[model samples]
Target: MSYGDEHRYGESARADDELFGGSGQTRTRLPDRAGDPYGGARRGGRSSSRSLVTVVGVVVLLIAAIAFANRGGDGSSSADDRGGEPAGAATAATGKRPVTTKTGGIPSGFTHDAQGAQSAAANYAVALGSTNMFKKDTRHSLLDLLYTPAAATRLRGPMDQAYSAEFLGKVGLDSNGDPPTGSTFVSRVVPVGTTVQQYGDSTAKVAVWYMGLIGMSGERSTDPVTSTWKTWTFTLQWTGGDWKIAADSQQDGPAPVPGDDRAATSDEISKAIDEYGGFTYAR
Candidate 1:
């Protein structure tokens, strides 16, 4: 399988670990998909793997309302990690409610403060990174539910173009986004943590670092499921009454070193996916 990343969605640039984006335009996104709240690491806006063996977090680009980026990452990473502490060690959740209700099976009715923005961005990451994004109906439903009206409107055309039939086939799905007869496809995002870069009364910028799983999970599968880490940033506005994404972007990952544990079998992975239900993320 071939792996490639592009810069078509007005690509972003990083300087000394600084993360920045173009206007509110979303880059092309077509991967297996999401559930859970936070999962990946922060890096560059590398594209999802283009063919078989693809594994990446959801990459959503916005056209006009993007804000936030990593401001500092200088000094030696080895030196920083020498203490054996976790990243974002200073981040702690507020006792405030992260969610209040669910609309269309997705978390909604978030508070208007920074915590609410964090909660919304985290949940939206799961929705955007899920397999549901591959289907026309569900995709549109998510767009309507997760994004601002104008942003969703601007996204429909490009998003459709990105999740083209050709792209779907490449990811082992049919035109309707279904997998093969005896195979099960898996795509999910689990957020690791979130940070607020810029927050105001009506607009807040939050970033989610998460881990994602995507691919075919079946015995005969040539491309068994794999994992990828990424950082997702969102520019959200307190719309109507809740926080809605105005624009967003993704980066590769500051992935941790792999462990030496043995890999699981296809059946094990598939069964696990089926048995482990997703949670309504509020982190």
Candidate 2:
């Protein structure tokens, strides 16, 4: 797969670490008397002001009347047809089934719909971001299983060079991509949600919003586990009766506000990561 920490696109996410913050837009407020609550201009000509107020008042009154008429009706289900989800809703799992089959330990047999593309992208993100990608053998197996045959062949050498021994050492992994004794290497991606950017019968583009945990866990480890928020975009092709990753990219962001809780200890973090298994994330 064209997904990994060493990929330039993935590296770009870390460079954007300082950019994480609230996503709220900064509202531009006009001078107190310049604007009115009903979007009326305070200093306009009398004739123009009257005309605007008349129009706005009528519109507002109509809207109020409509709302009153439907006040007690079944408006709850209308949320499903709201075009896009509300702010902060896209980061939540949709509770749909993930996949129907697996091959070589990677999810397969996704449905032939937008939801399928989303599920494939989410699962592929998890596989690509796993610690297994640091080792040659596992990486090869994953590529063979999840990527198109041609893409896998073309990417094998570059991926091998990307996961070089020197790179492994910098991340607290030994030459064989293993953490030292009594230490557990953590490199997992938990997809919070997925979206279909573009979809068709044969090809699709899906983006997976995920939180990744990486670093080494141990009493003596200098690099403690940390989390990062990212969005992984996969270009998938329906080939051989499955969705295969043709190429992929990643970007940082859509990060939420950090919580006020205290940081967990190494043992606590390791235990949580171990006990809490990953999910087959849906749309």
RMSD of each: 19.0, 10.0
Model 1, runs deviating above 4 Å: 1-89
Instruction: Give each model a TM-score.
Output: 0.70, 0.70
TM-score of 2: 0.70
How far out, in Å, is residue 158 in model 1? 0.8
Clash totals, every prediction: 24, 0
Ten-residue stretch with the least lDDT total in model 1? 1-10
Candidate 1, number of clashes: 24
Full-model lDDT, candidate 1 = 0.68
lDDT of each: 0.68, 0.70
